[model samples]
Target: MAEDLVLDTAIRDWVLIPLSVVMVLIGVLRYFVSKLMRSSQSPDAKIIKEGQVIIRARNLRAGANFIPPKSFRARRAYFSNEENGLLFVPKGQAQNAQAQMFSDPNMAMDMMKKNLSMIIPQTLTFAWVNFFFSGFVAAKIPFPLTQRFRSMLQNGIDLSTVDVSYVSSRSWYFLNLFGLRGLFSLILGEENATDDTQRMMQMSGFGFDPSKSLGAEKDGLDIVQHEWALPKFEQRAEAVLKKLVS
Candidate 1:
């Protein structure tokens, strides 16, 4: 068994602590910068109505059992009616809308802003860590890890003898980069733009698809088995009252 290496206390104070603090500060800064850069374009009235329709459909599906049968059927028809329902878009229209959304200059500009916000800080931070804190073992994990983790935990270090549990300075920075999401969420709100993983996912084409979302909501509303529970509740209340009287 390889002996545990005693890391210097200075490494923790100077490298690890400062690196964590810098990363956090950078994330907060990025959030504010992105917010400031965000365009205040007025949303299209049609888009707003479509979004509201989806919301109403979702609410109807969720609370269908609470409403009267006639009311439930009416609401479901308002959304999923084959002829003129709000959610029933003709097949090719949805594709055309998606294409138009992709071609919108404002959307392209907003995407560019988002990309710049995420990319600039990440590139700078990575460069800073590589230049100053390269090849230093900043910290070590308390629990033992297998050799498979060595490449992940000791990114800048090139030591075969070093324990896999020891984290290199560069690795520590990268870990803080991704792992501080919960911390950022706590500091900034849940919807803040400081989450790199989410931004990356969005960039990789996992972004919101309004047409698909509407279609899904429509399908969900269509399948809801609404059983009016108000009458059942009223009957139960009457039974309880009768029991009390008896």
Candidate 2:
């Protein structure tokens, strides 16, 4: 077991304060650069059509019970047709365009620009922090951390005498990288790419799930179990009126 050691105040003044300032500066820089990168890419027609097709199918299914029987049948027939339907039509919507859209040179370039923006800024930030501030037992967390987190939270410092809780300067920079997301959002509007956390989450299989496949959208619409809801609404309204009179 390591003995309790008191951390110096100079570490906070020289190390902690400057590291925090750098993190904020880097986030602000990332925001403007991301805006420039996004401004160049226009919405692709194929991608838009794909989303429209799926949305229309979902809408028709959900609102089917609410709409009149005649109107519902007409809408269903239009979407269910193999030749002209949004879900079934040939090369007419986003599903058909997915291959082309993904393969398009424009899309490839936009993705590259996005990756570059995320990679370059973070790489530089970490590199700058490591080069300038390495091997200093700067600060410790208020909360207890596990032994597993020892290497991660105290990167450069290998002193067995210090507890795992006492983090090095290198770890402090990363701690800010993930921890200051809320502050960054307040500084750069919530929509702006301040930390790229949301983007990374989306890219890392969290945004779109291939397992929840929409390949069966057409089949679902064709075999939908819908009941008339208007007639039931009329009966309820009459019941309320009769009670009010009584």
The TM-score, computed over Cα atoms with residue i paired to residue i, of candidate 1 is: 0.83
* Pairs clashing within candidate 2: 50-94
Score every model by TM-score: 0.83, 0.79
Tell me how many clashing residue pairs each candidate has. Answer: 0, 1
The true-structure Cα RMSD of candidate 2 reads 4.1
Q: After superposition, how far is residue 88 of candidate 1 from its true place, in Å?
A: 2.7
Candidate 1 lDDT over 184-204, as tens digits, reads 899898878855446657754
Error of 2 at 140 (Å): 1.0
Worst 10 residues of 2 by lDDT: 205-214
User: Which numbered prediction scores highest in lDDT against the true structure?
Assistant: 1
Error of 1 at 41 (Å): 2.0
On the 0 to 100 scale, the lDDT of residue 197 in model 2 is 46
- Tell me the lDDT of candidate 1: 0.84
Tens digit of per-residue lDDT, candidate 2, span 77-196? 787776666566444343444455456577567666777888898999888888988988888788787889988999999876678888999999888988888887787876867446
